[model samples]
Target: MGDIRRRWTVTARARSDRGPNGLSLLPWLLMGMGALSHLIQGDAPNPVIGGLGLFTFNTLYIAIVVRAFSPCHRETPLTWGLLTALAALTFALAIGYGREWLLLFPLLGLAVGAVVRRRKRLGRITVPLVLAVGVVTFWRDGWNSFGVVYGTFISVMVTAAILALDETVRQLRATREELARTAVEKERLRFSRDLHDLLGHTLSVVVVKSEAARRLAPHDIDAALAQVADIESVGRQALTEIREAVTGYREGSLATELDRARDALSSGGIEPVVRQSGPPLEPRTEALLSWVVRESATNTLRHSGATRCEIKVGGTPERVRLTVTDNGRGGDAATAGSGLKGLRERVAAAGGTLDSGPAPRGGFRVTAELPVETQASQEWETTG
Candidate 1:
């Protein structure tokens, strides 16, 4: 019983793996058994000629049907040439031996359907072929042979439909897998961008505060202690933000980012000026702008030797704009840094634009503008 069950399982698996192939059409060759029997009974007029013709017809049939399953070979001139020769041989046998030989018409139809994929092309080939079969059958076996014509037509249409649907299903499966891979890549990119923005700003703040504490320790113990306490607070906040980022649940706040920017700028000995004016912003907009603020402030502290940095945000209810400018020698945030480059892609995905370069007067500058409403923002709001 175990051996039998294993055999059955293997058979089932083999059939499934075969899918649509030449073997599926092989069974229909049994229809030609009638002609084979005539030769065996010695009823065929030219026994040797009949035998040779039957051998050639079966050979061509096998070649056409087998090649039909391979898309690369199906439409080749060689396959078409084989099919054409098969058609000629089928017609010769059916006309010469009208009784059992007429069954070859439907088999011919099956081969045509397997090779021709497009509906327009199939119709062009099969319609005339069906009419020819009807005329020939009328000549050989009269109206009683209408079944041959009907079978021929049905064979062509049904075969084409099944194969077409199978091809469509295969294409859909491939497309679905491609989309899944693309989604995974987008998620990885999002996580990397968040990590860069978060750690970049947090570490800059820590370093600046540490420097301030070190310098103040000799002169003012209380002031140095205050800086130390601020560092502790920033460290804890960074930990929570890092956790949130890891889980992909972190959301940014423009107000919180601006406050941190002020502290960071002060610790770095750079004067900070921040101004905001506009209708209340959407949370999504605030979040994007918050990233801009953090990156810009970090760059200003690290690269721009400026003593003063100005950050301004203003816009209407329909659009929002942000600009960060500094008075140092100007060559920092605008350079091709991964932080700004990734931030640019993030803004563009949300249907916004970011520009960073040297300001006209004498400083590095970064500016971003976004619509108040966006498709991504709406989806995020709805899901949240």
Candidate 2:
């Protein structure tokens, strides 16, 4: 029941979102005009019964219009009873008076509009029921077949088409909402992965420096003091990096990450070698590559037991590449972590690819290739 209520609420909101002022009531007003014309035509045996029937039909018509346009429109036992009574009244008026009373056929359409709220088996149930009503009401005159058929066709078509359109709009709105949720979830995952990588690398450096200070405290007081100072500096830097990341102001550059990676590798007792053979890159491309370096360095420190690590950056005119290789116990396909997965998503978003595997000569290698010439770059070149 709660699910049904929620669905109805969503449908109502979608319908209301169609326009600022809400759906136009012009059609119902036109229907009122047609009902007035039936009164003006003066084709009833008794004016009193005709007037009463007219009033009842118009009242029920207005009720139907209000219910159909309502945002919270749902079926209830009372509503069902009202629709049943209206149908009975309509049939009674047509039977007692002449066939002219059948001009109130729009009331049947209104009933159908209400019925569809509870059951959408419109073709199987409502359509046939409406046809049966028409047959019973007009069976007295063979010539009245055309009016019955035309009336039933118009009522069914109009009601079904409007309801279908409303359902479609509701579906589209739901799809848009779902897509928005997915985008936000992806961003949250990216932020979490970045935080993990940043803290993991920073804390590892801090731990190594603290351990060095502990070992050297008695032998060389100056060297121990220097290690403690380095630990303090690393902690402060980590704090600042975390602040920047949380505020969405943190942006990585290739040069900065490479320098930091070198320091981290050397602190972890691994020799670091860096090489570059690329022209200047766009800021976005640089940031993406910087992230690749950061994630790779973190993985090397945490997973790879290596004595040496090498970083390479190279590119042609069309694309740029970054490779981080470590002469460590190599990782297999199953060893890829969340940091690597996040890196893959980021690189792909920038129209790039990331590949990681055990290198041929032993150890693990991570490679990222990003296009140098994006749409913005092409436009700049053309304009220049």
RMSD of 1: 5.7
After superposing candidate 1 on the true structure, give the runs of residues whose Cα lies further than 4 Å from its correct spot.
1-18, 332-336, 374-384
Cα lDDT for residue 173, model 1?
73
Clashing pairs in 2: none
RMSD, candidate 2, Å: 9.9
Error of 2 at 375 (Å): 10
TM-score of 1: 0.86
As for candidate 1, its clashing pairs are none
Least lDDT summed over 10 consecutive residues: which range in candidate 1? 375-384
lDDT for each residue of candidate 2 in 285-349, tens digit (9 for 90 to 100)? 88889888888887787678888889998867788889889999996632356878878888998
Q: Which segments of model 2 are wrong by more than 4 Å? A: 1-98, 108-169, 215-219, 333-336, 374-384
What is the lDDT of every predicted structure here?
Answer: 0.88, 0.72
Model 2 scores worst on lDDT over the 10 consecutive residues at: 375-384
